[model samples]
Target: MKSLQDYTTVIRPDNNGIFAAYIPLLSGCHAWGQTPDEARAELIYVFEMIQEEYKEEGRSLPEDVELVIANAS
Candidate 1:
């Protein structure tokens, strides 16, 4: 079973200087804020909403999504 924490989260500052956070595996699951923490907090709310919707529709999140860290040499 996969939980929300199991998904990979990508956060970066956009050209406008707003912080954006999202789970790439979940389509339409993204949020933006003035800071990284704010963006992530909003994203968590969005995730909960999406999760509820999935539950209502009898759908389960994909099992293959996982967090990965890579280093650039």
Candidate 2:
């Protein structure tokens, strides 16, 4: 079973000063807020909603999804 912990979260600040949070492996799964913490909280809520939606639709999140972290300078 794929859980929220199975996904990699990417949070970054945009030029507009809003923080963007998303699961890169999940299409259209995203949220935005004024701070990184807020963005993350919103993302958690969105993820739960998405899970419920998929459950109602008799579908499951992709099991092949993988998470990779990289550092850039």
Candidate 3:
């Protein structure tokens, strides 16, 4: 089973002093909060909701990917 921690979360503070978080792997999955921690917490909830929706729709959940860089010779 895939867990929330399996995905990569991007969190940043917006100009309005609110923290915004989004999962790059999950399209349109985002949340906002007053602080980074709060934003992350909300993002977790968002992830759960998205996962449930996928399950209901009989779709497979997206998997996380790892990026690798290689030096060009």
Top candidate when judged by lDDT against the true structure = 3
What digit string (tens of lDDT, one per residue) describes model 1 on residues 1-73? 3566878888999999899999988999999999999999999999888888898899998764556778998
Every model's Cα RMSD, please? Answer: 2.7, 2.7, 3.7
Clashing pairs in 2: none
Give the alpha carbon lDDT tens digit for every residue of 26-61 in model 3. Answer: 997899999999999999898889999999999989
Candidate 3 stretches with Cα past 4 Å from truth are: 67-73
The global C-alpha lDDT for each of the candidates, from Candidate 1 onward, is 0.87, 0.86, 0.88
Tell me the tens digit of each residue's lDDT in model 2 across 1-73.
5666778888999889999999997788899999999999999899888888888999988763566668996
Higher-ranked by lDDT: 2 or 3 = 3
Could you tell me the TM-score of candidate 3?
Answer: 0.84
Q: What is the lDDT of candidate 2?
A: 0.86
Query: Which segments of model 1 are wrong by more than 4 Å?
Result: 66-73
Candidate 1 has a TM-score of 0.82
Worst ten in a row by lDDT for model 2: 61-70
What lDDT is obtained when candidate 1 is compared to the true structure? 0.87
Query: TM-score for every candidate vs. truth?
Result: 0.82, 0.80, 0.84
